[model samples]
Target: MEKEHLIDKYVQGTISEDERLVLEKLKLEDPDIQKEIDLLSDLKIVTELEDKTDLKNLLKETEAKLKQGETKVIPLFKKAKFWIAAASIVIVVAIGITSLLNPFSPSLDELYAENFEPYKNVVNPSVRSDEDIDAEKQAFITYENGNYSEALTQFKALYEGTSKSYFLLYQANCFMALSNTKQAIPLLEKHSTEDTPLAIRSKWYLSLAYLKEGNKEKARELLTEVISEGGFKTTAATRLLQKLD
Candidate 1:
């Protein structure tokens, strides 16, 4: 493929399977192109939050600038040929192109610094027969191990019955771990009402699931429920609740 057509097709997303394979290979080989993809991927994650009106406005403003000819295209960070460098200065550019093709692919959120870290010294001490506690525990272990399907199977086993709210909550967590927020929402909604130990926790998870599903009002309602509960507040949950305001 010619250089000009390759770049044009890649941007247009009209690249065929073969061209996409070629594009991926070229992105991995090229440092500069990789950075733009990484930034787009990172931005994509933050876009999931539903109540992000300020962000929406900002993007609209950026687009408006483009309409007004105020937008500047800074390829290679400069129009000057002499300023070109051989290596990418951004660490994300070097390490991120591989993550962009299926940017929504699920993984444990280790990048967030607070996601999925233990809230407290969580010790599962359930003495119930109905709830398959081992299965739930192993599900998270499998989640941490990156086997989403196996973990989901283990979680579904825990999903039956309502004896253990912890199992119920973590079952919902497994859906989240797999990035199946659509499946997660109803499970979390079932636990979102008061009377169970996990009610507040359910609202927290439900808000995020709503956000992931692009339902801001529902997310806001759930977040409000969490704040109003005045219980089950963890640092990560609290941060999310704060953002709703």
Candidate 2:
């Protein structure tokens, strides 16, 4: 504010040292003010470097050009309604965009931003639907409130939507939570090292699900493959082998 005041004072030829200090502070703090100050400083330097006689000649030439220019004045009646219509359209658009941006007012972005942390583990990453987004929100809501069954239902719906490996793997995790090993097998089997990140993950989870189901032979086979495949999923395979032995 003081920076703006200083600009006014400077423009009106009434600036003082104290006001100049305020302008400097404003220039340092606000990007827009800083740019204006840089431009003003450049003008001051150029004005000091140039000869007064040359500047006066340039001003006279500019004034002569201005005098030679056509002097047509636009009548306000010709475009009065056009301006009124344009202003009305601008006002309507501003209100509409503002409403869209603040549908929940200062909370939607902050709330979603808080919830949308990519670092957080997604229980059903494969689900990609508006309904699924809402269902998962409710599932997470229930999970937070310790309602495991409701969370599981929403999570199951998510698995159904995207037979994507992550969804399948998440479904297996949910099944393990519900203590239903029977449901985990097919889900895990669907994701067996087909080059997708989920393929690697599916292999790891499938081995664990097999072991959890007491089929040590199948678990051993998958665990061995994961270790031999030698890539991003190998560490998980190695860890599982260590635990089984």
Candidate 3:
């Protein structure tokens, strides 16, 4: 039999003595074999524990019966001690299942944390010297130094004074860095619609903003556009889309 078949049989607790000895020898030869066996064993436990719908339905029925004024003679299953034990088991099983599921299938917040990064200041590289430190230069400086709140103020002022659309992009980036997606999304949306070089880049940031806001549908939509546009963030967008799916 194949090595994989032997491992599967071992995990299912159905391996013959000879097959078990073979797997034990394989584990002695390779540490990764033992790790794989452990992972599959854990997954099997989680899969088996996932089927608690019957227990949950029974609890609900007991609750409904109690609510309907059945105070005469409760059955054994409806006893207070039995209800407490069953409810405790359900809670423990649910928590275990959630913990196991998270690694294989990350939550939206985890995915966003893994993927969302503030777009860098490629459009306006900050000058190293302080000789000609104008408002725009100072804004980029604050942004590059990770002072997002101050940078947000500076970028807003620059945008209002000069009516420059690129400043909007920087403002959105600052909001994103500050974990303020609600403020960032509209600015990114406006910049993304413009016919400018930075517009394509804005879509990528907008997708991340949607992700931070827990709007997966909108994030997926924007990421799809980023991929179809075939520019700066295409590869990253494709990977993020796969994770979302």
TM-score of 1: 0.42
Q: Write one digit per residue (lDDT tens) for candidate 1, span 149-232.
A: 775676566656435555556667767766777887777777665476657777777777777776767867766777676766
lDDT on C-alpha atoms for all candidate structures: 0.56, 0.54, 0.76
Q: Which ten residues in a row have the lowest lDDT in candidate 3?
A: 70-79
Off by over 4 Å in 2: 1-133, 140-148, 161-165, 193-195, 231-233, 242-245
Q: How do the residues 102-167 of candidate 2 rate in per-residue lDDT, one tens digit apiece?
A: 456534223222222111245433334546456656655555454556666766777678544455
If ranked by lDDT, best first, what sequence of candidates would result?
A: 3, 1, 2
Q: Give every collision pair in model 3.
A: none
User: Could you tell me every candidate's TM-score relative to the true structure?
Assistant: 0.42, 0.39, 0.58
lDDT of 3 by residue, 39-118 (tens): 44544454344344543444455456557754223122535544453355456656754554457687777777787777
> What's the C-alpha lDDT at position 172 in model 3?
92
What is the lDDT, from 0 to 100, of the residue 204 in candidate 3?
A: 91
Better of 1 and 2 by TM-score: 1
Better of 1 and 3 by TM-score: 3
Candidate 2, 182: how far from true, in Å?
Answer: 2.3
Model 1 Cα shift for residue 4 (angstroms): 61
Give the TM-score (vs. native) of candidate 3.
0.58
- Among these predictions, the greatest lDDT belongs to 3
